[model samples]
Target: MAKAYWVATYRSVTDPDKLAAYAKLSGPAINAAGGRILARGLPSQVYELGLEQRTVLIEFDSVEQARAAHDSSAYQEALALLEGGAERDIRIIEGI
Candidate 1:
């Protein structure tokens, strides 16, 4: 199976404290589910339509694994903490 990459790009953050709280729990939850964090935080540089925003990348063994992690109860809890905190675009991409 192809490896899967989970990506999250933050468009805007309205509540820093809430986002911080979500991060604290989400990190552990994702790690426990066999997701390896590849990169996170603001981009070093931006070009074209890209904006200087926070981005996160995580790797999983397969698409199934990535979906499972996202659907897991632990991750759900973490997600709940992020509600109304920020606007983000998230997706899972299969590796080449």
Candidate 2:
């Protein structure tokens, strides 16, 4: 099976404190669920309609694993901490 990738792009961060709180929990939660963080940071350059915002890329063995990681209770808890703190778009894609 093809590998999967979790791509998260932040649109805007309204509350730094809340985001920070979520970050503290999310990393461990995701790591425990077999997700490996590949990259995370603001873009060095933006083109087209892209905004220079925080982005994260995580790799999982499969799409199912990626989905499981997102749906896990631990991750759900972290999600709660992120609610309203920022706007983000997250996608799970099959890797080549």
Candidate 3:
């Protein structure tokens, strides 16, 4: 199976504390589920019609593993902490 990637774009961040908490908890959860952070940072540049947003890319061994990471209890806890703290667009895609 092709690898899977978790792509997340932070549209807005309202609570830095919650964001920090989520990051701390989610890291170990993702690692336990076989996910690796590929890239994470504010976009260095944007093209036409682009909106400024922080982007994150995480790779997983497979689509199933990616899904598992998202559904894991540790990640879920982080998600709860992040609720209403930010607006984010997150997805998992199969790598080519």
Candidate 4:
């Protein structure tokens, strides 16, 4: 089966404390769920209607695994902490 990826793009961060909490909790949750963080950073350059937001990319063995990770208790807890902390768009995509 093709691999899958979890992509999250942050539009804005409104609460630094909550963001920090999420960062701490999400790492372990992702790792325990067999997900690997591929990238996390600000865009170096932008073109067209480029957005000024942070981006995160995570790779999983399969789409099911990616979905599982998001639904896991640990990740759910992290999501609770991140709620309202930042405006983000997250999605799971199948790899080519």
Top candidate when judged by lDDT against the true structure? 2
Q: After superposition, how far is residue 5 of candidate 4 from its true place, in Å?
A: 0.7
Off by over 4 Å in 2: none
lDDT of 2: 0.98
* Poorest 10 consecutive residues by lDDT, candidate 2: 44-53
lDDT tens readout by residue for model 4, 27-76: 99999999999999899888999986899999999999999999999999
Checking candidate 2 for backbone clashes, the offending pairs are none
lDDT of 3 by residue, 3-91 (tens): 99999999999998999988998888888889999899898899999878999999999999999899988889888989888999999
Error of 1 at 4 (Å): 0.5
**Per-residue lDDT for 22-70 in model 2, tens only?**
9999999999999999999999888999888899999999999999999
Residue 86 accuracy (lDDT) in model 2: 98
lDDT of 1 at 48: 95
- Give the residue spans of candidate 1 off by over 4 A: none
Q: Give the whole-model CA lDDT for all candidates, comma-separated.
A: 0.97, 0.98, 0.92, 0.96
Our model 2 lands, by Cα RMSD against the true structure, at 0.8
Residue 1 displacement in candidate 2 (angstroms): 1.3
The better-scoring model by lDDT among 1 and 2 is 2
Tens-place lDDT per residue, model 1, 1-96, is 899999999999999999999999999999999999999999999999999989999999999999999999999999999999999999999999
